[model samples]
Target: MKKLLLLVGGSAGLGEALYSHYKNLDYDIVEFSRSGQQPEHVFLDMSRKETAIDTIDLQFAQLAKQPWQEIVLIINAAQIGPIGELAMSEPKQWWQNIEVNLTLPISIMGRFQTHFQAVEAPKNIAFVSSGAATSVIEGWSLYSATKAGVEHFIRVVAQEQSSKSNPITPVILNPGIMDTQMQATIRSSSEAQFSNVDWFKQAHETGQLASPATVAGNIAAVLSGKLEAGQVYDVSG
Candidate 1:
């Protein structure tokens, strides 16, 4: 049986880096993304919450035909920035960010938990989370709140899966400040919405940010079970 690597949001950024690395590692890869650039990738529009769950289900059903010893789910899709104070932010966009960063992954994890409950194969679920999960950044109320919410969801998943006979490993990976397009978006944020915009701008200007490829390697380690489960870990460490 082959190792199956499932990537959500692999069209670009760190997710793309992860896909490339794991594809070379010989895992049978599956991707879910909005771009849908390849025939093998399952089309999943992060903006369309209504269809996301079903798309995941359909993909899972199709992949079930494969005889696999392990399944690793790496959730790298994030709706990072309509950056601003929650009250001042555009309502619809803010809601969508929450939907992408928090609701979507949780719902998908729920499906994974139920589907694999009876399967004895080793499983690993990892989320590409951020320090924003705990750090309160001014003008980033929505982003901060959603990241924090995601970590709590991780905690719950850890607890829920701990007692299973052939338990799934869950990891919340804090990949540090990676040099992704998301960083550029943060650098371009208005001061009114993101007070620490200058910090991000400076980071990029001085080339201080970590490369996505490097962080992607660290995340791969977590998914490979090099790190302990049910805990929050920083890749830099």
Candidate 2:
């Protein structure tokens, strides 16, 4: 049976790891990102809502014509910026962060459900959320807020799916701190900008950070296992 993997932000970090993992399994992979090293990557800027939705709509139109035994949509695109205190950060950047981390994911889920509602194949949607969603971290107000919002949105989606005869499985992921570009950004921040900068640096120096590939593998395992929809799967655990 042919399988399809539609991934967002599958250019680098854990997203890249997921792309490679599924590709190795001979799954037809299509990745959406702003820029990517892989030829399969389709440029779709999540920061621009309307354009991004249009792009996904076009892609879904084409994908609907294909026959697949299973289809998975994993949304890993996120922004972790405006790291400083909330009062000192620019409102424009905060809004952009919210759009990428929250708005785009929700929009994509809606589009996916709408387009594939009649498809008999098994459908799965996973969002790469963070532990920050439930924790309070200084200087990470926007990131935490948006992530929290994404988590709750997943729960709502899962509830809605419970009523459908053919429901899409929704999973929320808490991929712990990994040695990714996002971690590099966190480690690069000054103490003034990010109070936990030293802690992240120590994790890197002491080899406490998990590799993106390892986390990606764990996520794949969770998706394949007996997963309860809407529950947050922590890769570290």
Candidate 2: C-alpha RMSD after superposition: 1.1
Q: What TM-score does candidate 1 reach?
A: 0.94
Give a tens-digit lDDT track for model 1, residues 128-200: 8888888878877777788788888888878877787878788898888978889888887888878889988
The alpha-carbon lDDT assigned to residue 166 of candidate 1 equals 75
Global CA lDDT computed for model 1: 0.82
- Global lDDT of model 2: 0.89
Task: Supply candidate 1's per-residue lDDT for 96.
Answer: 93
Off by over 4 Å in 1: none
- Model 2, span 1-237: residue lDDT tens: 799999999989999999999888888999999987787889999999999999999998899788999898999999899898978777888889999998999999999998887788889899999888999999998899988998898899899998998888899988898999999999889999998799899999999999889988998888878768899988852
lDDT (Cα, 0-100) at 11 in candidate 2: 88
Q: Compared to the true structure, candidate 2 yields what TM-score? A: 0.97
- TM-score on alpha carbons, each prediction: 0.94, 0.97
Cα distance off (Å), candidate 1, residue 105:
0.4
Evaluate residue 219 in candidate 1 and report its C-alpha lDDT on the 0 to 100 scale. 78
User: What's each prediction's clash count?
Assistant: 0, 0
